[model samples]
Target: MKIDWVIVGAGFAGATLAERIATHLDKKVLVVEKRDHIGGNAYDEYDESGILVHRYGPHIFHTNLKHVWDYLSRFTRWRPYYHRVLAVVDGKKVPVPFNLNSLYALFPPGQAARLEEALIDEYGFGARVPILKLRESEKKDLRFLADYIYEKIFYGYTLKQWGLKPEELDPSVTGRVPVYISRDDRYFQDKYQAIPEHGYNQLFRRMLAHPNINVLLNTDYREIENEVKFSRMVYTGPIDAFFDYVYGKLPYRSLRFEFATLDREWFQDVGTVNYPNEFDFTRITEFKHLTGQEYSGTSIMREYPYADGDPYYPIPCPENEALYKQYRLLAEKESNITFVGRLAQYRYYNMDQVVDVALKTAEEILRGI
Candidate 1:
């Protein structure tokens, strides 16, 4: 039962690290995932109508890091892609990122230009007087901004995602949201953007193809038959569960989705459209927009947030963080285990940050090994 390392969860955090450590460091690792799949939430495969759908939810790979992009390139060639978003407000659909195109599309042409000038004058972006950093004026405040974003783009969607009004959640939760001045509607502005040409599952399959990495799907980490054989264990599962919930389970928000196959060729021209004014669901994502697969049919998903489930988004409130601290302190006392990834760290991180953290954590662990 001897092994060099026991890595838990086969998601990007563990799978990417396993590839690096086993290939370069020549470490014999046992990779165990609580779920039945290797790709975790990023897993995608062809659906009934030949649409490559995101099984858990929609995820776009966008990162500013070149090393990560290069490292993953070893696994699969990327399909050149750019992600965009739209909002449905007052029966009008427009681009997200709040750009000029969306402005002109939303308002009458002349009024749109006037509003643009006024907004730019008030809130200069990337300039000496950046609106985001400036002190609030008598006219500008939390209430004003929240109301504006909520009414036009975020309120209904936020309500759909959190099951609460935008006012109920901390502004910090929504603070990272922006009011962009440029006409660029691309949801993310990154150098390299793509879905794996084959698929995410294939990339992960190649990532864990090394002889030294043994991946066990359909087996939860808790069900590992072997006992204390490895020198160290990296547990990427939920931290509260790792400690057996001694600190009362840390809060996490999850989503439930209803996917459908439309008889039409397309649902929307854009990939995603946020229902800022309609539907209990936050947004509808058309798989056709994401995958670029050609077919007479299409697939769409309506995302509904739930208070309980597999713990997607960690609750951002300080009380939840304080509780996570107790579990972390207990994890610190464990001599042979390391916690990693979103659930383990109890933070909301994008795909790149998780991959970067996994790479860094693997580097630290290699020194120890």
Candidate 2:
């Protein structure tokens, strides 16, 4: 079909851009998604037991940007959700980020008190210190505390998630693991934190429901690229694949999810539990905690990081990033194509971040049109 713009991959990136272009600019846009559904990895649906579950994994929408939050609010109502995660460290489940409350949970009262005082004195109250930065402390007690957290929490999880040790990976990856001096156990401290009321699929449907937008599911763009007539293209798939891997395929980490339905109402104390030093899988997420759904039967998903399967996470290492830069240079030379999203950019981005970039890209494309 003839169209003004052809969007590849109908996830948040492509869907958001298509909505903006169709609604604002009143342009005819065709969105081709390889998957049967939209929303990409953020896709969620009801299972056989009638409980809503994230098909890919848990996606808690949290953003400090008011515009991004407000933009998405146009399509879906908000379900206020503050995500809490616990890690199994030393046979006890404690709050993640190795917070002060966790300090007391893992150590004796006297020892925890001393360590807390030292942390407060050094970093001040409520300060979030990166685990790597905390490890560089000159103080013996602080160093020991960092070491304890590294071994018990960060080390094994990184190994299983990325197939690399904490130190072996990029600093940006390891730096995400921090030590919170406050008792706040919430995984994110954003100003706006909530999930879409109906689920991400519903939100995507509303966003792409404009008359000027046409959606074709289970259709690979590559198969129809030569036949489809379009003025410009927005690609959200892997950047390396778009260029036929001229610089070789960019390394990506995938996930294998195992879902279980139990006869109980709830499964865990928190939304997610990390098994850093315990199991082959990184974590287990209960759908009830995430969806806030009350049902007799509950569902939980176990995420196992794998090297095969569809690309889920871009490997954040120096070598992989450098290889992506080479492909990026080729992408920049393509005047008619705009590459946006996590896979296209080869960066780890949150859902809101992806939306923000897509909106910006759409604005730029509209100006040129």
Candidate 3:
């Protein structure tokens, strides 16, 4: 069969590129996914208890990019959602990013008030400061507050999540959850933050609904590359795997998720509760709070980070990035093949960021075509 493009992986990168190519460029594209389903890690479905649960984990869609928001708006309607996360530190659950409100939540009012003034004085009232950067403060009170946040809030979590200390991993990893001086308890202050109205699965279906696009699920692209005729290839799988691990495998941290259904209306006060110091699992995510599903029973997932599993997080460090650069060099050598997405790029990317990269990749292809 004649195909204009053969896209590997039915995730955001492949699916978005395929949609753009098929709809805008009117090109015949075939999407090959190794998994039995579409939507990749963002895939969500109803459990036996009839509650919508993210099969991989809770993926809260939040982005500051207006173009990314407007592009995704084409396929699915959105349910306005602002994600909030509470971290268990010293037996008290406080807002993560350890904001000004989080200070009041954990400390005595007098001490908290003093620290707040010091924080605002040092870094302004609305500033978001990285815990490590805050730790560099020369002031005694500020230094104590920074150390308290690091030891209590960040250190243990980073150790468990990446199997590395706060200092070892790339600053970007720790920078993700910054200490906000503002009263904003919301995890992300992004301009657009919402989940698909139906689900991510439905969104993928709508995206790949075009006549020019076809999806082959549970099939590796290598199994049928010879069976079809395609001009160019868009690979969204692991970049190292694409070149058959020529330089060696790049390190990654993976998560093992355990889901449970409770008879109660809710499990946690918020959508997610993070255990920074207490448990083997990092956090527990309640699906009902995220999806806004009114069910008598609630479904929650416990995330356990491990060495072996489906690659979830690209381990951010100088060594890993150096290894990834080798594969990136090889990818650049190939003219007809385009590599995109988190795994392919070996970078930590949010859902909208992945979509934005896919759109750009598609645009590049269209310009050449």
Candidate 4:
């Protein structure tokens, strides 16, 4: 069998490129996926209780890029949503980002007021100050506030999620762990925040529903690469695995999710609650809040980070980046292959970013053709 393009994986990266190539370029493209289904980690479906749940933990779509949002808007209608996360600190559930409201939630009125004034004076009202950067403050009050947030909110959570302290990871990651100076409890401050109207699965199905695109699920690309003829390849799987771990393997942190269907209508006040200082799991996400599905019962997922599992998060450290750089240099030499997405690039990316990358990759492919 012959095809214009052979794309590996049926996730956003692969699906977007396949759709673009098939629709714009009018070329036959085959998408081979190891999983039986599509949408990659963003896949969602109604649980046994009829509540929509993300198969791979909670994925809240929030992005500042208008082009990314506009592109996806073509496939599925949007459900306006703003994601909020709370953490168990001193037996109280406060906002996860440790914002001004979180400060008031944990501290006494007078002390909270004092600290709030100090924080705003130091970093302004809406400024986001990284915990590590805040820790560098010469002011005693700001220093104390930074230490408090780091210990209560970030320390245990980071330890559980990444198996390393905030300081041990790359500064790019640690720098993202910020303490918002505002009273906003929303996790992301992006310009647009929403979920697909039906679900991520529906969005993916519509995205890959072009006449020139063919999805072959439950099959690895390598098994049929020899039998099929294609001019170019677009790979969205792990970069290390594609190269067969020639330069050893890049480290990754995996997750174990435990989903429970409760008899109650709602589990928590918000979409997600983090058990930072206690429990083996990092957080519990209530799916109803995310999907806006009105149901009799609630379905929640508990995420536990571990070493041995499917690669979920690429560990952000100098050694891992160095290893990925070596693989990237090798990938750059392959002129016919276009590598995109989280696993292929070995970098953490938001859902919108993945789509943006695939769109740009498709444009590059079309330009060359």
Candidate 5:
């Protein structure tokens, strides 16, 4: 039997679109996933120790988009979670974003105040800017902050995380680290920030529960896509694989996660910590903090960065981009298929962004349906 839609990859892209299209457009969708479960890279579950752990490192739901938050809230309740990050620096645990609180906490009160004045004088008051982004700021004025941040927090950590020199990477990468004048140490300042009350798996389970949606796990698209016919297909898997890499392998960076359970009640004060100064691994996350799980024992994950793994991130290289552009042109030429999601688009988007894309994808598909 021919289905109205065939959605590949049960991650946020395929799952969100499948449910939305099936319900709103009255179309039947069959979502096939290579993985056994749903929710994609942001998938979370309670471990054997009863701590909710992210299967693929840490993922926080924080977005300025109110509509994305509202759309997700329909499926699950949220726990008000303000993600705070601590960076290990100079044999001390300092809060990241290099805020006023972190500064005062790290140095003498008088010196901290003086340095704050110097910074504000250079960047202007309430600047809310990354040091690198300040065009007219004097080099001498930035020398202290930039050198200190680069050495203590950014350099080694970035090297291990992405396997690239900080200088070689995009300036926007460094722009993410802001030197704040306020005591707000929270990592994200998004208007809406929260974690799912029952975890993301349940949210996905509810989203894809429509009768018009069929799910097939551990199914290879190449093996079965030709056998089953459909009106149209939405693929969220890697675009390179779809066309059998007719151009060349598009660049992607992947991660490796090692997790363990501890007999202790707690491990860290916060959800995430960046150990830039100490270890080969960039960060070690305690699961209970992120999941809001109340349990005696705790679970932690150690992340190791490799040259390549499962292509968690698309390397923002020029050559790969040109190749993806060629594939995109080919996809346009093909006409019957729509490619969405991080792997397909070769973008580095978090959960909310993927959801937004999926919602838009559904709307476009329904417009034609």
Candidate 6:
């Protein structure tokens, strides 16, 4: 095949770039996906019970970036879903981020009222304070609240998810767990938050349907790299793997999902219910809530964090970052190869952020060409 660009991985990163190059730059692009499917981690499909479920895990599309939302709007319509997550604390489901509403959910009326007033006085209303930052407060009430959240919500879940204590991991990872002073139970406050009307796979199919774009599924780029004729390469796989892990393998945390189809209309109140202090798995996600599916039977997935699976989350630690920097230095020297996406960049990025990065990378490649 005569290819102007070879895109490794048919996820958002590669698919977006291939579509842009084919439609805008008028280049023939070849997308090679190792998986038998497209859409990478965001892939979703109907199960045997006729219930739509996310294969990898629950991916809620929420981003404040207008350009990113506008770009994806070309492929699929929106479902306008506002994600709500609940953490099982003290035998009750409380809103995650440990908001004021959660305090009322878990504590008595008098205590919850006192804590809410104190929080508003200290941090002001609607302020989002990191759990670690709140823990450092000189005030006794705030410190107590922080300790409660850290112990009940953050500590156990972080330990299970990353296989490390919350304090042991990088602050960037731990600090992401915030305590919102407001009563908003929504998981994210991004301006635009929704799921694709159909599924992510459908969106990917539309994105890669351009005449100049060719998709090769279940095909490894390494197997065909020598045979294929392409001027430039866009790699969306692991950066270390691309260079054969020359600087040692970068650490990543993978997940094992156990899905079950139950003969019920709904499973949980929210889309995701986090089992922080109870279960071995990090959380359980009910797909009907996220997908807005009206199936008679519901499907839910239990995410068990493990070390031996496809790379899911790049472990955010000082040592891993330093090692990835070495790979980045090597990647910079390769003029024809461009690495974009979560695994390739070795950073934890949301779906919209990955799309934005791919768009920027595509523009850069076009200018260079």
Candidate 3 Cα outliers beyond 4 Å, as residue runs: none
lDDT of 5 by residue, 1-369 (tens): 679889999988988889888899888889989888898887888788767888998888999988889999999999889898898887788888777777677778887787777777766665576645543356664676667777777778878877776666665566667777677889888899888989989999999999999999888877786788898889998999888988888877778898988889998888888998687788989878877778888999998888766878776656667888998888887777899999999877778889999888878877876
Stretch of 10 with least lDDT, candidate 2? 168-177
Clashing pairs in 4: none
lDDT per residue for candidate 2 within 71-122, as digits (tens), equals 9999999899999999998789999978999999999999999999999999
- Which stretches in model 4 have alpha-carbon errors above 4 Å? none
Give stretches of model 5 more than 4 Å off. 124-126, 134-136
Expressed as tens digits, the lDDT of each residue in 1-369 for candidate 1 is: 788888998988989778877987898999987677889889988888889999778888999999888888899988888988888877888887666676688677886777566556766642222223322434443335434555777666666677666555655566545567676778877898998888899999999999999988777766764553787788888999887898788877898889999899988978888887777777889988887788998999988888888878876666777898899889899888888899899878788888899989888877876
Q: On a 0 to 1 TM-score scale, where does candidate 4 land against the true structure?
A: 0.98
For model 2, the superposed segments whose C-alpha errors exceed 4 Å read: none
User: Which of 1 and 2 is ahead in TM-score?
Assistant: 2
lDDT tens per residue, model 4, 65-92? 8999999999999999999999999999
Clashing pairs in 2: none
Error of 1 at 262 (Å): 2.1
* TM-score, per-candidate, Cα-based: 0.92, 0.98, 0.99, 0.98, 0.95, 0.98
- The backbone clash count of each candidate, in order, is 0, 0, 0, 0, 0, 0
